[model samples]
Each structure stands twice: as structure tokens, then as C-alpha cells.
Target: MKDFSAEITYKTSRSSGAGGQNVNKVETAVTAIWNVMESAVFRFDEKLRISEKLKNRINSEGLLQMTASESRTQVQNKKIVTEKMLDLVEKALFVPKKRLATKPSKGQIQKRIDNKKKLSEKKENRKFRF
Candidate 1:
């Protein structure tokens, strides 16, 4: 149920890509805006998390802007913007798996103690014969 067309607003700017005269003349770079409150792309909790996580990226109006000027063509810029938006959305959705608490095994503890005893023995042997 991801309707990116309605969710995003695009604005084009002059591109610096390798298009010779076309790059300087045509405004092909794409800048897209996603309205967090209005979009159907993210749920309530997801939007909240995204807002919190990307607080610096969001403007005072709570809009997320992504600019793509890497390519000369408008189509390519549009595609890049879409891909970047998707990546941001996916990153917001991800929850890191928690690590379980674990105690060292008896064998591991025994080996560590054994190693310490060996080290102590070696140091003791190096002491002056007084």
C-alpha cells in the first residue's frame, strides 16, 4: 500500500552531471519531499521513530527532503530519489536484535585459571634464588 507518487513532492534544479551543454541548460536534478503527517507510507509509530531518528534531517515543518542531482537526466534523478527514500523508510522500520546475557562456561573459566597459574609459575621461576 505504498503510494510514493502521492507521498512525495518533487522539484527539479540545475544538474551538474556529465551532459555537456544539456547539464548547464536544463534543470534535471530532482528534490523530493515527504510529508510525515500526510503520507500513507508510514504508520503512526514508524513516523514517530523516523522523526526522532532523523530529527536533524527533518525541517521545522516535519518534512523530509531528499535531493538527487547525481545524474543529468530527470528520470535518473527521480529513480535515485525514490531509491533513497525507500532506503530511509527501510532503515526506520528495522529493529536491531537484542543480545542475550550469558555466563562464561565452566571449561572456559577453568582454562583461564589454568593459564593464569601457568603465567604466575613462569614469573615465580624468574625471581632471584634468595
Candidate 2:
């Protein structure tokens, strides 16, 4: 979605999950790597935003990595990994709307106080007399 295809690199290895002998013979696992620091797809602010939001995923060398091995074919695995990587980057780039702090309205506050008073009155009425 962000035109990161040019900046991504892929590595393949034997898939570990399933496929028995086929797994041993073929390299279906795909690892997608992107160098965030050297990426031309994002501006400086966006780069910083991604780095900050995805700090755990990005290594010291500024490489963002994702792996996919569920598919039996290398091409399918590559596609899955690429999609995952794009989703990760897109999520990291998103900025949430800031929240504005405000006090409760006078009527709301009064309603809360009234509820508390009613509860207290009920509790007091439940007390046993000597």
C-alpha cells in the first residue's frame, strides 16, 4: 500500500511447521526484510514515527523483518510475508487522534452525587435499631 516493494528484500529457508519430506527438500519459508533507515518510501517524520511505534520489530541495524512459512510453496510464502510486512509498516505509520481532557458537566456531576446519596440513604435504612 505504501509502495515499499522496491525497498524490500526476501530470504527463503526450509519451512519447519509441516509438509514432512517436502519441507526438507524445498525452501518454502520466506523472510521479508526492510531497512527502515535507508528507505526512500517514507519521509523523515514518517521514518521516525515507524521507528518509534515499531521499536520492538526493528533491530539495531534498523531492519524490519517478518517471516511466513505456513504455505507449502515458496511463492505463496513470499506473498504472505510481503503482505504481513506491509501491514506492519502501515500500522506503525498510523497516528491515533489525541484526546481532549474535560471535566464532567454540572448536571452529570449532580446526578452522580444524587445516586450516591440515594445509596447511602438505603444503607442507613437497612441498619438495625437497638
Q: Report, for every candidate in turn, its global Cα lDDT versus the true structure.
A: 0.84, 0.91
Ten-residue region with minimum lDDT total, candidate 1:
1-10
CA displacement after TM-score superposition, residue 120 of candidate 1 (Å): 1.3
lDDT of 2 by residue, 20-78 (tens): 89988998999999999899989999999999999998999999988899899999989
Locate the minimum summed-lDDT window of 10 residues in model 2. Answer: 1-10
| Positional deviation of residue 18's Cα in model 1 after best superposition, in angstroms | 3.9
Candidate 1, 1-130: lDDT as tens digits: 2545667889999977588999879999999998876767768887888888788889999999999988778999999998898788678767899999999999999999999999999999999985
Candidate 1 C-alpha error for residue 61, in Å: 0.6
Off by over 4 Å in 2: none
C-alpha TM-scores of all predictions: 0.89, 0.92
